[model samples]
Target: MPREVRELAEDPTGVDAGTQDAVLLFVGGPLDGRVEIREARHGEPLPTVTHVHLHGGPKVVHRYDLTPLGPGVGVYHLRPQQVVRDRSVAD
Candidate 1:
């Protein structure tokens, strides 16, 4: 199931001053169960894409798209965007 979060981050413009911080939840793929606090205004839209970079052997990039649960609440589900390989690493 997707987790619900409220817009708690303070607006830099002082329009939506919040006490807590807003969060984006990730479900599935390498970022499952990850919660990220993001700065957002009261009426502004949230981010739609999340990028994750992995380094060790060959560099890999993972992309996740936001799936809105409700206002200020959404889940980032892993999408088959692409897997980038380092140029130094042979295919």
Candidate 2:
């Protein structure tokens, strides 16, 4: 995954230099099922995308949508979000 992200970093897609929303995913789990994304309202939990489940464990890709709060922002749905960087392209 890190190698893939490294290639994405050099993407010529004109990614800006700021924050971006990226989806993280775990390799295996109940989370492997379909997931949804909801909007975060006032005083509410931020929007999140459930990626996968760790077999009999908790949701692995349980995290909020990293909506870019600034420029250079990009989004990539990565099976391993922790490894994939913002504005990175797929290898």
lDDT score of residue 66 within candidate 1: 78
lDDT scores in order? 0.64, 0.38
Question: Compared with the true structure, what per-residue lDDT tens digits does model 1 show for residues 1-91?
Answer: 9999757555444443343345679877778899876666443335566565657775556667777665456778778766455799777
> Which candidate leads the pack in TM-score?
1
Give lDDT tens digits, candidate 2, residues 1-91.
3554444565465553323233222223344333333222222223444544566764456443434333332232333346546567765
Error of 1 at 78 (Å): 0.4
| Candidate 2 ranges with C-alpha deviation above 4 Å | 1-9, 34-91
Poorest 10 consecutive residues by lDDT, candidate 1: 12-21
Clashing pairs in 1: none
